[model samples]
Target: MKTLGLIGGMSAESTAVYYREINRLVRERLGGLHSAALILWSVDFAPIAAWQAKDDWDATGRALAEAARRLEAAGAEAIVICANTMHINAPQVQAATAIPLIHIADATAAALTARGVARPLLLATRYTMEKPFYRDRLAALGLPSLIPDAADRDRLQAIIFDELVKGVITPDSKAAALAMIDRGRAAGADGVIFGCTEIGLLIDPAELDLPAVDTAIVHCEAAVDFALG
Candidate 1:
């Protein structure tokens, strides 16, 4: 098996999910034979989150690039960022290492293509949704992208910040997120992309009539596939 390096903890919440999923997949695939060859660099998310709250991509990009270089030096065969939003710096991170950086967008687009989806709704941090980089990736794969309304984006961000990332899930947040799902369905979405890893904490495929894709799960599956070689 090849080694997997994780650029993680831009909120340890989703990072843990990625770790568990990789192990479970490997164990199921290989039947508990020493699990996956994994190396994780769980960085403090607080600094990056602060910059993000202020839209400081330059600082975050530099920090993340440094993290990628460190991981490469540590013998990682290839790398993956644990959070979707942090992937804004994916190019920089990839440049920092000779090893591959498995992009979340690549994984997601591949899944969408495999399912033959030509269009889909996107739900994520306001930065991720409003930003061109994220949607452009889906568009590059011939998928149409739809985003939530500004008010819905605000509500979703709050759930992500206060509840999901903090691991403080609550009944009220779940209901509110479901309402957002309703709005997305009305917006002509073929399906909703739960773009934020933490958002998956509040919603899932069965909660709404629209098909849902969890980016974290999709990304982890991709990383596992790459690692299994």
Candidate 2:
């Protein structure tokens, strides 16, 4: 198996999930006693979060590129930025390394396509929702995106940063997220993309009637595929 490098800790909460899921998937695919060859570089989310809040993507990109370089130097054959929002820096990271950077949006788009979803509601950070980076990727795959309205977008952003990222999952927050999904359904979304990595921690796919794309799992599976291939 190839070594999979991860740029994580955009929020340790969801990064932990990525770590677990990747290992679990490897073990399941390869059978007993088999696990992935992995290298993880967990960064301080404080400064990264600050850069995101300020919309200072240049600084974020520089930091992520440096991280990717370090991982590449350590012999990682493929890179996975373990958070969806951090994918804004994916191109920069890819430019800094010879190894592949498995993009979260592209992975999610592929999953949505396999599930036959054309228009999925995207629930993520304010940056991800407001920016064209993610939506454009989906559009490139012939899948248009449906986002929550302005007010709902603000609420989702706050919930992700303030509550979900911090590992505080409450019934009220889950209810609020479900309500947003309902609104998206009303607005004609055929499915939902838990575009924020932390969102899967809040919304369970089995509980939802609509098909949901959990980006963390999708990205993890893609990394595993590349590693095994």
Candidate 3:
């Protein structure tokens, strides 16, 4: 298997999910005792969060680019950024590395398109939802995106940063998120994208009534495919 490099800890919670899911997928595919060959560089989220809050993407990109370079030097064959929000720096990381940077949005767009979802409701951090990076990626893949309104977007941001990042999951938050999904469905969203890496902690995509794309899983699957090839 090829070594996959991960730029993680945009929030440690979601990075753990990526670690677990990637290994799980490798094991399941290759049978018992098999696991992914991967290198993970998990960053401290606090300073990154502060930069994000300040809209200092250049700093964030530089940090992730450094991580990618380290992983490449350590013999990782492909790079994966663990969080959806962190993928805003994908280009910087990619430019800094020789190997492939497996993008979460590209994998997600492929998954959504394969599932025949015309418009997928996006539930993520405000950066991912409001910024052009992720949505533009999807559009380039021939997929349009649906998102919660301004107020609901704020709620999602709070739930992700304040609660989910801290590993706090509350029933009230889950209910509120579900309500947003319901509203998105009402708004003609045929599927839901767990655009935030940690969103799976709040809602199980498998249990959702509508078609759901859990980007963490999709991203891992893509990485595993590349690794095994």
Best model per lDDT: 3
What residue runs in model 1 are displaced by over 4 Å at the alpha carbon?
Answer: none
- Model 1 worst lDDT window (10 residues): 203-212
Give the Cα-based TM-score of candidate 1 against the true structure.
0.96
User: What's model 3's lDDT at 48?
Assistant: 98
Which has the higher lDDT value, candidate number 2 or candidate number 3? 3
Ranking by TM-score: 2, 3, 1
Alpha-carbon RMSD, candidate 1:
1.1
Q: How well is each residue in 1-229 modelled by candidate 2, as lDDT tens digits? A: 9999999998899999988999999999999999889999999999999998888999999999999999999999999999988888888999999988888988999999898899999999989998999899889989899999999999889899899999999999899999999999999999999999999999888899999999999999999999888
What's model 2's TM-score? 0.99
Residue lDDT tens for model 1, 94-203: 88889999999988888777766667788889899998889998898788798888998998888888778899989988888787777767777777788998878777
| Candidate 3 wrongly placed segments (more than 4 Å) | none
How do all models score by TM-score? Answer: 0.96, 0.99, 0.98
lDDT at position 156, candidate 3: 92
Local lDDT at 11 for model 2 = 89
What candidate 2 gets wrong by more than 4 Å, as runs, is: none
